[model samples]
Target: MNTITANQLKTRGVSIIQDNLLKDQELVITVRGKEKFVVMDMKHYNYLRECELDAALHQAKADYQSENYITETVDAHIKRIKQ
Candidate 1:
C-alpha cells in the first residue's frame, strides 16, 4: 500500500494513479490528517468483488449443510412480508 496526500493527488491527477496501479500498487489517500480514500485498479477491484461473493456463497452452503437454514416457499414468504 502507498499513501498519498489529497493535495498530491490533485496536483498529479489520475495519470499518476494509473502508473502506480500498473505495478499492482494500491493507494491510500488522506485528507485533513485522516485516511479518506483508496485507489485500486479495476482488475484488482473485480477480483476482490468476486472473492466477497464466493465467501458469501460458501457460508450459505455451510449453513445449509448444517441444517441451519429456514425453508419457505416464495408465496409464503410474500404473505408473511405483506403482514
Candidate 2:
C-alpha cells in the first residue's frame, strides 16, 4: 500500500493518486494524521465485492446444511418482516 496525506491530496488531487497507483495496487489517505480512507482501482474493488458475495453465499449454504432457515408463505414472510 502507498500512503498520501490529506493535505498532499488536496494540493495534488487525482494526479497524485494516479502516480501512486501506478506503483502500488492501493493507497491509504490520511486525514488529520489518522488513516481515513483507502483508494483502489475499479478492478480491485470489483474483485473484493465478488469475494464478499462469495463468502455470503458460502455462509448461506452452510446455514442451509444446518437446517437454520425457515420456509414460509409470501404473506407470512412479509408479516414476519413487519414485526
Candidate 3:
C-alpha cells in the first residue's frame, strides 16, 4: 500500500495508475490528512467481489441449516426448474 495525497493523486493520476495497476498495488488517497479512498487494480477488485459473493453464499447456507430448511437433490431441483 502507498499513500498519496488527494491533490497529488489528482494531478499525476494517470502515471500513478499506469505504474501500480499491473502490480496489484494500492494507492491510499487522503483528504485533510485523513484516509478517504483506495485505488486498486481491476484484478484485485474482481477478486474482492468474488470473495464477498462467497461469504454471502456461506452465510445463506448456514442460515438454511440452522432453520432446518429442506434442500432438494440437484436433479430434482433441475427438473422442477424445467417444468
Candidate 4:
C-alpha cells in the first residue's frame, strides 16, 4: 500500500496524486498515525461501486430463486442493522 503521512500531504499533495496515477494505485492518507482516508482514481471508484451493485443484485436473485427470505417490520430491521 502507498501511504502518505498528513505532513507529506500538506506539502506534496499534487505530486503524490500524480505519482500514483501512473500505476493506477490507491493512496492511503494517514492522520495522527492512523489511516484516515483513501485516494483512488474516479474510474476505480466507479468500478467498485458497480461491483457492489452487481453483487447485491446477484444476492437478491439467488434469494428469490431459493425463496430465502425473512419477514420483519421496518423498525425491527432498523434495530438489526443498528446492532
For 1-83, candidate 1 gives per-residue lDDT tens digits of 77778898899999778776776558888998799999997788999999999999999999999999877999998998899
Return the candidate ranking by lDDT, descending.
2, 4, 1, 3
After superposing candidate 3 on the true structure, give the runs of residues whose Cα lies further than 4 Å from its correct spot: 21-24, 68-83
Question: Better model by TM-score, 1 or 2?
Answer: 2
**What is candidate 2's lDDT per residue for 31-71, written digit by digit as tens?**
99899999999998999999999999999999999999989
RMSD in Å for all candidates: 2.5, 1.5, 7.2, 3.3
**1-83, model 4: which lDDT tens digit per residue?**
68878898789868877786667568888999999998988888999999999999999999989999878999999999899
- Highest lDDT scorer: 2
lDDT of each: 0.86, 0.97, 0.82, 0.87
Between prediction 1 and prediction 3, the one with superior TM-score is: 1
Q: How accurate is candidate 2 locally (lDDT)?
A: 0.97
lDDT of 1 at 7: 92
Better candidate by TM-score, 2 or 4: 2
> What number of clashing residue pairs does each candidate have, in the order they appear?
0, 0, 0, 0
Tens-digit lDDT string for candidate 3 (9-44) = 789877876676556567777998999998887887
Lowest-lDDT window of 10 residues in candidate 4? Answer: 16-25
The residue pairs in collision within model 2 are: none
Q: Write down the TM-score of every candidate.
A: 0.80, 0.85, 0.70, 0.75
User: TM-score of predicted model 3?
Assistant: 0.70
